[model samples]
Target: MDIQTILQELELLSTERTKKTYIRNGAHEPLFGVATGAMKPLAKKLKKNQGIAEELYATGNYDAMYLAGMIADPSAMSEADFDRWMGTAYFYMISDYIVAVTLAETDIAQAVSDKWIASGKELFMSAGYSCYCWLLGNRKDEEFDQEKLNKMLEIVEKTIHNSPNRAKYAMNNFVTTVGISYMPLHERAVAVANAIGKVEVSSVKTKCNVPLASEAIQKAVDKGQLGFKRKNVRC
Candidate 1:
């Protein structure tokens, strides 16, 4: 389907009420405020079209950019594409979910993640941590640098308490991903989560709280569901 049709469909699916609700979650205007769940069928229809995704993303509409990430082909993407996407990613949902997921599957995942994290931009750093979460969840233990991950976990343990706004929350997510997705790191993740304790971030009117990493991990463990890796991290 064409971009115009996709956008029209998004508008049909959007509501002013939902737009305001998304605003609370940090969505910028010129968005249809279509929920992520509502966008999946569209993504399925669009499939993975790198050129079209780039076109939609460049429109600067929040929902379209987000959908671009979902439908874009990461295998055909380069570091330059990520750089461009990052420049446009002002929304947390787009940055952390869309940009991060696509980048995490690339061969240069670690390099890109490190560069973004070092930038210390809130969204970039959050996306970087999110990349790590996806990487750890999808890769086998031997495929990555074990020592580096340990040190990264240590960094989270030490600095998560003082990390910037959403970065702390993203770091907490890294801990949860490690605990629930990587079997060998479960103990270490739990320890790190315990040490970090409660994570506080800016409030949403939805009253949704930042989940404690420890409890989140434990819930998975209690259900005998810990250590299972996801087939894919894309939404």
Candidate 2:
């Protein structure tokens, strides 16, 4: 699918009421709000439209740009394009896309890690720390480095301790991403749970629950579900 087709789909699926509600909630201004609502489906579409995704991103839609990073063929992207897109991506998108990239390509792992460290945004930094933990836990090319592991543990601890409520979701995302990458990181995930003083690690467990396209799209196709629209189109 092309960018136009995706945008048309978004317009068809999203109503004026939903858009107004977003505005009412004070989320319409920030670009991430657009992403949180529209970009997931867009990403699914762009998984097959690398060139169109790149073009749409260059048009200055931050949401599209962020989705491009999530769905584009990472190996096909130039280092310059990747760096530019990373510089502009939202924190949460960056966090999630880091997981996608790590899962898909190990050659860019160190570069992605360095970018995550330099992100400076608390959420992004926390995500970087989590991604590094995932790499150590999952990648077989390098043995687990105790010093690096200690550093990640320290950062995770500090992030949880300093901003418990503010960082809760991002922390959960981090743990979830790590768990998805390396199930052995479950112990570290539980440690994150303790540091945040949560009784359960449910959020971490649910963070990586990316449903299949057929399932997610079927939900959208179901009658009475949110975002569902009736039309004569085949899935």
Clashes of each: 0, 0
Off by over 4 Å in 1: 203-209
Error of 2 at 209 (Å): 20
Tell me the deviation in Å of residue 221 in model 2: 34
The local lDDT score (0 to 100) that residue 180 gets in candidate 1 is 89
lDDT of 1 at 83: 82
Which ten-residue region of model 2 has the weakest summed lDDT?
226-235
Worst 10 residues of 1 by lDDT: 201-210
lDDT of 1 by residue, 66-140 (tens): 889889999998988898899988867888888999998799888999898889898899999999988888888
Q: TM-scores of the models, in the given order?
A: 0.92, 0.53
At residue 86, candidate 2 shows an lDDT of 49
Scored by TM-score, the top model is 1
lDDT of each: 0.86, 0.47
Mind giving the per-residue lDDT tens digits that candidate 2 earns over 1-235?
6667755555555555655654443233333334244556666645545677577666454444545545555566655665565455444444434433432344565566556556665544544555554554345523445455445545655764444322344444454444333344445644554554541222322433222322322343353342222231111
